[model samples]
Target chain A: MSITSFIPPQRTLMGPGPSDIYPQVLQALSRPTIGHLDPLFIKMMDELKQLLQYAFQTKNTFTIAVSAPGSAGMEACFVNLVEAGDKVLVCRNGVFGDRMRENVERCGGIAIMVDNAWGEPVSPALVEQALQTDPDIKIVAFVHAETSTGALSDAKTLAEIARKYDCLTIVDAVTSLGGVPLLVDEWQLDAVYSGSQKCLSCVPGLSPLTFSEQAIAKIQQRKTPVQSWFLDQSLVLGYWSGEGKRSYHHTAPVNSLYALHEALVLLHNEGLEQAWQRHHRAHLELKTGLEALGIQFVVEEAYRLPQLNAVYIPEGIDDAAVRSTLLERYNLEIGAGLGTLAGKAWRIGLMGYAARNENVALCLKALESTLK
Target chain B: MSITSFIPPQRTLMGPGPSDIYPQVLQALSRPTIGHLDPLFIKMMDELKQLLQYAFQTKNTFTIAVSAPGSAGMEACFVNLVEAGDKVLVCRNGVFGDRMRENVERCGGIAIMVDNAWGEPVSPALVEQALQTDPDIKIVAFVHAETSTGALSDAKTLAEIARKYDCLTIVDAVTSLGGVPLLVDEWQLDAVYSGSQKCLSCVPGLSPLTFSEQAIAKIQQRKTPVQSWFLDQSLVLGYWSGEGKRSYHHTAPVNSLYALHEALVLLHNEGLEQAWQRHHRAHLELKTGLEALGIQFVVEEAYRLPQLNAVYIPEGIDDAAVRSTLLERYNLEIGAGLGTLAGKAWRIGLMGYAARNENVALCLKALESTLK
Candidate 1:
């Protein structure tokens, strides 16, 4: 088989995640890969933790990137916090929330799911009720921003309710971390995880994760070892922790970390609040344009995530046909609906570097022309 | 914390893994980010699989890269095959073998370990003896090439022994793939995993893995769900499988895959056997130079890995000081010994792109000056 070098076509990514990456981040990714245990690389890791802490708006020292994707970060949180027979109240609003339940089950933990409609936010009241009904529920888990449906839950309120019930909270901030306000410390989120490809606008693969002292304490007190050795936070702590000389765990994805560092630097320079507002402003523009074209959004305005806009496919309009046309003709990528909304909706993302006036206009124009 | 952009200093990497990456591979990594589901990206993914199959010298349809590092790939093999209460025969020749035992125990499988001395190859006779003693052993696991001690085990003979006992095999080819003759299909190996960073000379996140049909059948017949949801190969198979349409398991590390594709392409272009010979030739050059400098090799020549050279530090020489001097003055990175050999040995790697005459000369010259 004669296989040559693969040259990927450049496209405007308006998908549910993996939004347009900053040019600098891409450049950083191409930099020379150094030894993961090199002193210089270790120094960069420390800086990366600080940058992630700033982005998550937390003082949690356990903040570091998992070497895999967002799902692994989700798995890391559950496998480390939930032990065998431990009852966890998982709020299932969208795909990620359901994934949390799977993580819990795989870790041998009992999941008490609080179901919500696909296009709606996780109800804080329902979560509170579940925890109250099952006082044995040791941890509460929910997605802060559902990438599947563009729904944003009230993470602070949900976390507060979990705290009131004396339960630790695990938050999936994959789509919310940089595009919206995610005050991990203020919300008292014990465990939170996100993807680098989402609002962070870095390449996919690395998962930015943070854990509170309570979460670390729970891990330290585990009766059984974490099922997945790659995800076990107790062991990973030795490598990421700055207390002593860094120990060899696995080879850190050196270049990906470089991209994440550059992306975080851009976010810090832009200012977190400013970046969130930029996403919101772009969403408003896109919403107005879509409304003018008679397209309707899936989630209500109040609970909608600015970065991820899920809109119902108009009646009699073929979903695949429209997305295909946009991809082929315009070199634009708008996500197909996932899970429950597979054929009924389309997810248009305005995340990080993709959250710009030009991208919004291009997407609106492309959709209008394609529909016509 | 005002952390600006992290500019990593370029160093000549002579480490056990994360050896010098090819420049083209680095360029491929920085390409504009694309969606994981982008049709173009999927095409690249298919090509990547073919390239990996060529490198491993296997036509196993189950070949794919694990989203994490080599350690995670090891976890995937054990978690999918060895169920709770299943008996596994693990051979401990170096650090990775003991890690395999950890993986087995974490999966609730009983590991009957056959101990071999560090810096020595795993004895196929001992493995046959262990499997013979434990008729119930479902699998035999060993590292084909030990990065810790630079010992190259006889994978072909060991796999033959395992098959003779009606057992599957798990081989860690992290430091062997693309650097030596790893005939996966010819040897009838069941399951094997490798690191992209090692001999492949790609960046360090992804793990190239291949599983024989027998291994897949065993996974399909598992009594319980794979303990780690992230590493559950059965689920990942849907994403990597070239069936109707690729399902989303997790966002593939898009850019890292690009780098791997390019690295594998370079390997294919050079011919796998040619690449192996290059590594061997570089090792000879390095060996002559190190011997001239009064250094001693840790592993005997018969079973030593050409890609990884573990050598003893001279008496009265401070281990850290020499390495530090090499780093600071020469901008070169050499690996300190790991596990049992730590502080007593230095590992100089000649893998993939780093396995060249120029690199050997630089490493030898750097070592000579630092020792002086």
Candidate 2:
């Protein structure tokens, strides 16, 4: 039983998530682990919620980080809001949207899926049609940035349409939050969830989430109990909200939360607009280089996500062979296509700390050789 | 908007959990984050499962870490095993047991609670009687070690009793797993969940869970969909099992899993029994010092957990003042009481890497000075 400590190889993480974490964030993670209920930890939590709110651009009082990953954050929204027999309109454009439909079904809600093409952004017109056709719909759910296809939907327009039809909105900002422009409060996004790993430049765990007053009202008036105890936002609110001694819910991934705090702090230091522009600039550089190489983007240029670039693989390129060669030879990792795009497209991410000119140049250099 | 990076103070952790993480584990946590589907990461995942199996003392193929805290692991067992309308017998000796009843109720199961006094072990006689009274009970759930009260229940005997009644057993080994002797396979415990931050000496956020074949069978035969999309064992199994090409569920907490792998590796190096003895030896030293200072244990001596010692505060002692002084003056951290024990007792934990003679002596000395 002489097992030595696992020393993971350092690779350039240019995938959909588990994005390149900042050195400060990694150092924060290695800090002395503290009791979840320690007073200083609670104070830090308060600052974290504030930092998350700044990133989310929301004044939602219920803003906090779930101790799990983005999927749990997605589940938290569905399980807490979608009670049995409730009708929800889910827009399906990529893998995450399909996961949303599954979440609805598992929560015992009736999902009316508005289907869009795999690489296309979710259409507000289609969602409006679904809402107009089904007046019983209680919620409108869609992915802001579809990680699988690099499509960025117009969340503001979608939220506006849902509000016009008297339905709450749940936005999956997992790949959007710090990487793109997302004004949660202005959009009136009722419930929003994002991953720390994608745009926050933190380790993969802990989902930053916020619920508008309307969403809180919906949760408060839920007819049926939330299916999962760990995700019950009503109970979790007691632990995350209010002043003075917060109630204990589950153990907050103390170290991960610390890393998230630091990541968000970095985001704040960089300024949200600069961060978004940095991602866009880096994306432009990578996109131009890839275009010169005869690569085509899966998503249309107008709707393509700045942080996640989904490019089609050349007909003769072996997907696994190319990716493995890149990993082994250059120590670089780009995401393989997910779901319907599998074997057809590649996803190269320019997320958070990884959205730099140096990273973009390295990726292009690596790809130029790998393609030859 | 001017938020500096969070630099957490270094405190000697003597709490119920997030217990003084091993330096190796912390280093592992700060390792370069990898893609969840990275081949090397997958190889590490297999090793993690094997280490977890060894720690669980089970060869259950379903042993893996849930990318959340222990509370979610507890919910996973209840939501996956106790279907809607099923009757589950929950033994409530402390806060965690009551949390089990909540999980059962949230899962839409009828909870037949066998109440034991707080600060006491779950009585086998009462559990047996509950089983006799409730023939419809499909599952039995209890805490192996109650964190709130420092009481350790006999999981082996309890599992035997549940099996004798033809009921599946769900054990909460959150504060027990790496600290005490828990034979999952030998006791026929159907489902078990543990925290990484406890005696595992890892950073918090991940839950190590294992399910026996019988439990897997029950989950597979479930009539209704598991209430949680993220926690549905059937889907999670796809990601954790098989030889190659693991399916995508959620992005695993890559670095946290790295830390857990290192923690379990450390445990394997020390040997589980030796780790348990270290906790016991440290607890005895702490107990003697505490007793000499006129402090008494909240739990009875025979039933107390070695890792978590719930000791009553001496008369005229102010809990907050003493804890604050320790943190400020000596950079030591101890736990405050929880639930009914709140304001009345202090929980002094001797767990995993924190279970050392130096730590024990330091804690006693800090308390001696703080009390003065």
Predicted structure with the largest lDDT when compared to the true one: 1
TM-score of 1: 0.99
Q: How close is candidate 2 at the interface, in terms of C-alpha RMSD after superposing the true interface residues? A: 0.9
Candidate 2 lDDT score at position A135? 95
Model 2 stretches astray by more than 4 angstroms: none
TM-score of each: 0.99, 0.99
Candidate 2 local lDDT, A102-209, one digit each (tens): 999988889999999998999988999989998999899999999999999999999999999999999999999999999999889999999999989999988999
lDDT of 2 by residue, B238-263 (tens): 99985768999999999999999999
lDDT of 2 at A365: 88
